[model samples]
Target: MSRDGTSASRNAPLVGTLLVLGYCVINSTKSVFEGSLVQHLSPEFIAFNSFVLAQGFYFMICRDKAALLATVRRCLPDVIALNVATMVSWVAVLYAFTVFEPAMANSVILGLVPSITIALGFKLRPGVRALRLEVVAALGMLAAMSFLVAAAWNGSSAIGDLPKDDLAAGLIYCVLTSFALSAITYFTRRLGDQGMSVQQMMASRFGVLILVTLGLLIGRDSFDAYTPRNIGAILLISIVGVIVSLYLLQAGMVRTEPITVSMLFGTNLIITYVVQFLDPRLHQSTTTFVGVLVLSAAMCLGAWARWRDGRDNPPAGVPDKVPAEVPAEAEGTTQNVGNRT
Candidate 1:
């Protein structure tokens, strides 16, 4: 383990870029699936797909049959929490879609993501402190929000403008979704401290979601018996969103700081909007534009914080566990969870 805060085996810059590209594709596909996939399958069935595909991929990567079950049992609780949060987030977003336009709802839902994550950070990891440059980063986030406000974004109008009751329902869904996703990020960071591979963490997380889905099927829905469309959506989600995109996230987070990773993911706001703009059928409005700018400012805040971290190390309160050199599989055996940084 190197004394530096990051893991010792710095994945090559080229490799990291490739990972980002991979995730971008996966995530973009996910954007499509989020709006479209639910029409074909039950949530329960989708969960099972995650389990099967993620598990299959994890095994293929590790190829260590002996340690797999033991590792899973060891981290079961954290994994389950992650899955719960994940399911909640998905449900919330889906509910939002039912009540709002995909573009508007997605913007607001994701626009609030970094702010929600900041709240989660304070709640979950009490010891960690925000860096001075984080203030600047925070300012950037605010700027981005301003852009969004100018855009005059409203989720309901595009979806036929729900009634007052439906609007209330939509708000609840968005909030729940945000809370769940925020917690998922916090828990994943904790799992990282455990030295688990991104693959392992994802496998365990998705694996539990599958179980939850199966449990839901006992009487909840007839999803245990999959139809062709259900099977296809689940398979696509597992393969693209969970297996491919998440590996990039895992590799990126291992190389990057947690907050930085959050910022990177937040960039999806830009990605989604740009995609919306290019789509002639997807009309943009005033409030939506305002929201984008405002959110852009917030993202800048996150970026500034990372830039500052590069100048000086992050506060030592958050212990650096995995040496940059040690592989995820080697966490328990080779690396002592000492502050290698």
Candidate 2:
């Protein structure tokens, strides 16, 4: 790692953009499936089935068992924490969906991810400090998120309004989801520091979630409620959302700062709104339009931060300690985690 405590690859900006875009798309699609599937299935069942299926997919493609074993051994605590955090985030989000509007839930919870990730990164790796420009960018991003949520509440009633009965539970679950996701981001970076590949992390995480699911299923009648449609939805979500989305996330986080990665995920709100706008049946109010403008300005600030990083070699005052040329995959002996498939 550099003196700045970042393991960022040379192509971090390019790779991170692609990874975030792909993740946003997958998450948007997953919301669709969850909307349909959650009606007939319990959150535990959906989570369990998705992880089990995703683990199976990983097993079918995973190679370098010895290296994987070593990585797991070296990072057992991080791995366990990652798994626990991941499950909690998903379960909370699933339940939040039941009690709140999709936009409302994401607006409240997802904004916390980037801020919490920055705090966690600083705590875990003492040398990691946000550049002044990056701090400004992060605050802009948060402001944009607040604008979007306020828009949801004030305008486009269909996009943001929630029932009074479910408000307390929804807020609680959203808070849980946010904190858990932040923890997941921290552990992901820790695991990356231990030289674990994306595939290895995915395999270990889903494998652990599966085990937890089985433990929850003990003496329960949960499996009896499965239907072919819901089962198909689970398979789709497992493949696209769990397997593909997380793989991109793990791969990207290895080459990017965890806080930056989480910040990039904030784009999911824009993506979700865009998806809704494309649907002919829905109509957004004037407030949504103004919110989009504010969010776009936030994105411009974020883009400026990335541009500043790329153009200013020494980052204004910091000494040039990072290697001029480092192999992107030098973190571990098992180089290409994505190669097996």
Best by lDDT: 2
The lDDT values for all models are: 0.54, 0.60
lDDT (Cα) of model 1: 0.54
lDDT of candidate 2 over 100-182, digit per residue (tens): 44545665664455455566656776665555665565566467557655555454434446455566687678778877866
- Lowest lDDT sum, 10 consecutive residues, model 2, at 332-341
- Which candidate's TM-score is highest? 2
What TM-scores do the predictions have? 0.71, 0.72
Q: Which runs in model 2 stand beyond 4 Å of their true positions?
A: 1-23, 144-156, 159-161, 214-224, 246-267, 277-300, 314-341
